[model samples]
Target: MSDTESNSSNRQTGIATALQHPQPFEESTIFDEYREIMTRSHEQQRQIYSEFKAFTDDVASWVKAASQFDNFRSRKRIKTRLEWIKAKHGEIEGVRREVVTCVEAVRAALSMLGGITRSLKGFSGIVKDEFDGGNDSDLQEPRSVDCAGPNQACAK
Candidate 1:
């Protein structure tokens, strides 16, 4: 067979295979799976928040200790310590912003999913209510950030 004919034959075979073995999850099942994934993500975020909090606390303690020393050695140590503290503070800030962004994204996604669910359920009042006074200002705008600059680590 020619190259074009061979390519068409392969495409037809692929389509036939895909049709024979359809996706296992229905629309509702897919939504449930997504919700489960989000739940796990939330748990991971909580752990990250705790870890970062502890790290920030440790940095704060070091800063406090560095403040009490007056010797030349302490002065030298303080310089490096301050730099470390500053870096950590930046990391903390980045994580904070990331958490905020993730929360907003999740909220938006949930809102969309809620709409889909309502539509699927044949609820007519939801759309009207959403437009009337049920809308939240916080969900209206998503916060954005630039993590490509120097010293900017994109928080996962």
Candidate 2:
């Protein structure tokens, strides 16, 4: 056979082997742990969002009520209390700080979740392609086909 024909035959054989033995998706213990952490982070984000919304809504209601009231002294007192100092003897400042931290954490979790989702999307077709009209046995051993020997496939 010519060199061109030999290369074509090798390519065809490698492709057939790869199609016949696609690997199944296997979730490791570490992956399960990360998934659990992500689930908890998602739930915490919801709770923090609710708490932050409620805090803001309460402040808005106070401002609205203070404005509508006919008593000037009461309005002043309410507005004065809204202005907070971290050094003062009050827990509102600390709570606000914690809310900010929670929001930051939520953003971080969202980034991690996006990466995991992308990875899962890439693997989404693997299981279907592995099992569709093939792999007759339930416990087929995983097989890998190397089209190129060692690192010869790399251009570098």
Candidate 3:
């Protein structure tokens, strides 16, 4: 096969593999295999968040150190330091963006899980309510998160 055709074939294979193993959605079975996958994803996402936070903390420290470098120096060294500092800041910013994206994806999965859980609860509620004819309070008010400042405290 020609180089182009070979590349195309490789791309097709990659696409096929990606579609074959797409991210897991919530399953109905009690022993859902995908639950483990979801849990792993959650853990991986949390790790990314932790790493991003550490990167941000390091950037904060670097910025504090840079602020102390007010003494006049050679133009070359000054330019090099400025460039290095900017690059570090940019790297931290990129990680922050990745963290946001990863967090949002994990949050979306959690939301889907929440929906499935609620549906299951509703079904169980109907069955329980039928047997005892009792009112159900499983559906409570949604908790609100305060994402205003650095610390996100969930409002009760």
Assess every candidate by TM-score. Answer: 0.36, 0.28, 0.28
The candidate 2 region of ten consecutive residues with least summed lDDT is 123-132
lDDT of 2 by residue, 1-156 (tens): 999999999999999999999988677977999999999999999999999999999999999888778578777887777664434646877887887787667656755433222222321232111112234465355333223445444221
Tens-digit per-residue lDDT, 98-145, candidate 1: 977876776577576434222222222222113212356555543333
Model 1 clashing residue pairs (backbone): none
Best by TM-score: 1
TM-score for candidate 2, residues paired by index:
0.28
Model 1 residue runs over 4 Å out of place are 16-25, 71-156
Model 2's C-alpha root-mean-square deviation from the true structure amounts to 56.0
Candidate 3, residue 52: the lDDT equals 100
Instruction: Tell me the lDDT of model 1 at 105.
Output: 74
Against the unseen true structure, what C-alpha lDDT does each candidate score?
A: 0.70, 0.64, 0.65
Query: Per-residue lDDT tens digits of candidate 3, residues 16-128?
Result: 99999997755566446678789999999999999999999999999877766644346668899999999999999999999778767765676554432222231123211
Off by more than 4 A, model 3: 1-73, 115-156
